[model samples]
Target: MAEEQMNFQAEVSRLLDIVAHSLYSEKEIFLRELISNAADACDRLRHAALTQGGLLGDDSSFRIRLKADPSARTLTIADNGIGMNREELIDNLGTIARSGTAAFVQQLENKAEGANLIGQFGVGFYSAFMVAEKVEVATRRAGEDRGWLWSSDGRGAFTVAEDADAPARGTRIVLHLRQGEEEYLDAQRIRQIVHTYSDHIAVPVVLESKKEDEPDETLNAASALWTRPKSEITDEQYKEFYHHVGHAFDDPWLRLHFKAEGVMEYTGLLFVPSQKPFDLFHPDRKPGVRLYVKRVFITDDCAELLPPYLRFLRGIVDTEDLPLNVSRELLQNNPRLAKIRQALVKKVLGELKQKAEAAPEEYANFWETFGPVLKEGLYEDGQQRDTLLALARFRSTTREGWVSLADYVKDMKPGQEAIYTITGDDPKALAKSPQLEGFAAKGIEVLLLSDPVDDFWLSMVPAYDGKPFKSVTRGGADLDSIGGGDKKDTAEAEQQDEAAPGIDALIAFVKLTLKDQVKDVRVSKRLTSSPVCLVADEGDLDMHLERMLKAQHQLDRSSQRILEVNPGHAMVKALAAQVGKDGAGGVVEDAAWLLLDQARIIEGEPLPDAVAFSQRLSKLVEKGLLAG
Candidate 1:
């Protein structure tokens, strides 16, 4: 057969134009794409050798080689894998040009987020145009004797010709770096990109030997980091892989790298980033935890590798036992892989618990970054829930920053049957909660859980130990009135409130007046100075959380509140005196609404009806002056 030369299809021309011009903002990413393609080729050959009887035959220092010539302004990336013949090249490249263009266009329209589109779609080969004026791929299939050359200027046309001197079983792509992009022709630049994006690539990546007296200094570790024994690798090496795989440099505050060889055979090198990345919340952030089959790169998008809640983790997992073509969907059930996944979950959580136990301060930092993430597992992961609960940390009524369940338990007051908590959006407000009421008098510490996800995690875990978590604002927490416990001071306060003129009658009046807005109004068993505090009906959502959910558009409206009043307070007495006065409707209603307004404000909630709250407060002051 003879060689063939033709122009690119018109749409291919348009796609090439986009790839070269508007597709990628950082042309350097083209190098990453090319190196990734080379790594993928090597991974295929490695997998085939193991499963498909060595299509590559012998000669197994499997690697990708790079060559650059500054004078010629050319950068070449070569891979010794299952190379393509002319037909394969045309199907892979030309197929995209003619039919794949629309798919890529649709993708561009749907996700116009950032310019990291090479890995997002399967057209990474065309990304060469971002920096190259022309690209040439000379290749030979591993089992074939014939060779081929595929060349294109990326203008919708390409030429396929016979090659007498191509590698016997490899593909070499030479990129003629354009104008300002010619710097890529520097061997040093190529080496940097390979180390960053393709370093952990199961096989070695070799760069051309530039020094006359020495061989090529391999730019990457070239060895799989996961397969190595845990003791032999330093923490620095662990952190480096974390950065490479995660596109981050922050040290990993915690790491779990090991191989499970019993029921399943897989090596995992995972890291917990010391600080959360900016894209931690991005819905499209690529999962960089690569999957490998016997050191052959499979896919980084394998959600089965780790649950979505643990997406913040980064690393590699190389498995020697799985089939190369394992459909990602099948990861859920492959018993061996599932076993491996289970081990990984245990290993990560165990490491976190060990860290928190070993160093409280370091664990505090980890909590600040990932505690909420860990808490998420409490609700979603049932089998792992117990471990995550033990690993949980919190801020309490007593601690400065974070307190573990163990620490809170150590400080539990004698005879305290329930661990108490008060949930409000603001810490300071909750700290002063009149609802925290008698709990403070008993000298019992309460956990101050305030994150938006607090309610969700708390729902999963009802009790830490034998003590059930009791929300202070619940309507009927009968905190056995200071009894013989701390009655000295409470008794004195009770006497003072009782002696205050008209106090008992006023408590009755405030309750009757605010009946419509309150669930059930009663004299406070926990009142100190404040006249009234609102509690939610027994077992209702925290007042602050209900409002927060509504603020985030998660809830429609707030639940009603339980209003508790101080019996011995003078204001309750004064308001009580005028309860039955002739034409006291406007004056008494104004005073009741004003008390409700002030109570909600102190509890860190907004008046639901600000206009009415204002009008009522104005009238209260006017009526007081007329009485004077």
Candidate 2:
């Protein structure tokens, strides 16, 4: 093949510029990225050789070699693995093959935080430009006689040519160091970087010195960390392994290292990050785990390895029973994979349960960061719904910190029949809801749920520990049956009750005036301080859920709400006396509409007509001033 010159993809050019100028803060990350890519290539070749028989040829040993020459100002990384051919080299190195290029670039422009978008996009090769002025790649694909050389200067164009002197079957990347980047040519520095980052890689990473007197030395441990016995690994080794695998800077919050044997054999080393990833909620965020079969890398973005609810976990799962040639299509819906997933989920949940019990404060911190995400399991995983509900932590009107459902049940009042809860967008706002007034007066506690997922999970999980979960904002809440009020308060309530005929007339007149605006008008036992509040029907959707759906354009029409008036309030008593003196007239009708509008505003719902509300209020104030 003749040498060919081609222009880099437009996205590739933008990405290279970002990498060279702003992608990474530390220059040593270039070596980590290159070594990680080399390790992946070696793993791929091992997996391919399992079925291809002679693909390994005479050189069965798989390894990576690093050579640095201070005089030449160059550092070369070589690997005996599944190398790319001519077309593969161009497509992989010259273009942004994965999706979301535009979004990734936009993130770079918006944030000054140095992000590892390379791993997410599979463009770690371009990271070489961070420290190198130019890069040259020589590779020969396995089972092919021809080889190719790809050379680029971190500019808009690159050249490819046939290389007859390329190795038998692998890739060698030579980076020409920039002026100030000559420190990378130091052999000791290269060894230290490998041990710090790639020590857990299964392949041997050998460093060849520039001095003739010193022999070649293997810098890394050359064994899979997960495959080793748990007792043999030190805490620092485990932490370093997690840093390398997760591409993260902080230490892990928790680590799970275990092996399942007998029938299905697999080893898992999973880590929960101390802080959330920047893309934790990104719609296109890839999976954090990598799958392997007998220590050979298979796929890193396989969703089948773990349920979507646990996507925050990062680690590797290597199984001995899976076929070396298994493809992702074959792994999906496979019974073996399903069984492994089930077992892994159980183990993860059990570990979390233990942690929550042993360290309450630490678990509370974890919940603060990931509770909303974990609550998703209640709706998605029915089989584990009970476990998840029991594990959930909630904020309540009575507690100083988070309380579990079990603790709430245990702390139930003497005759409390159900667990009361209220949902909204903010906990502090929900705490001031008029619907909670009566409960507060009676010294009853209600859970204040503010997460978006809280509305969903509460609907799916109706009850816990034989006590039903009841929403305080719904009409079905039975405060009387729950022994909420005492005899003395009941007597005080009777003294304040409106005259029977006057109250009856007041209810009838208000209902008639607001009939078109509300589903019904009735006296309320749930409001102690407020004059009126809104409540949903027993089977109607939650108020918060309805508002959310309407805001999202998923619901076109608003559901009618029932308005409940507190006869004990001074405003309601005055309204009743006024209605008894005069029949339902325009003034009385205006008052009815104003009461309903106020309730709607308190419930976080927009008024049906804001202009009418303002006009009516202004007229009432004018009439009051003239009379005074």
What TM-score would each prediction reach against the true structure? 0.71, 0.84
| Candidate number of the best lDDT | 2
Candidate 1, 74-187: lDDT as tens digits: 888889988888889888777553334564454444334325333444566777888888899999988788899998888777889889888888799998878998678767
RMSD for each of the candidates = 8.5, 4.3
Off by over 4 Å in 1: 1-63, 72-200, 209-218, 230-235, 282-288, 426-429, 481-504, 548-558, 568-570, 581-585, 603-606, 625-628
**Against the unseen true structure, what C-alpha lDDT does each candidate score?**
0.72, 0.83
Write down the lDDT that model 1 would get.
Answer: 0.72
lDDT of 2: 0.83
lDDT of 2 by residue, 174-271 (tens): 99988898889887788788887788888999998657898889999999999888999888788777766776656788999989999999999999
Those runs of model 2 whose alpha carbons end farther than 4 Å from true positions after fitting are 1-27, 48-61, 80-130, 133-178, 211-215, 282-287, 483-503, 551-557, 580-584, 625-628
Candidate 1: TM-score?
0.71
Worst 10 residues of 2 by lDDT: 110-119
Candidate 1 lDDT at 112 equals: 47
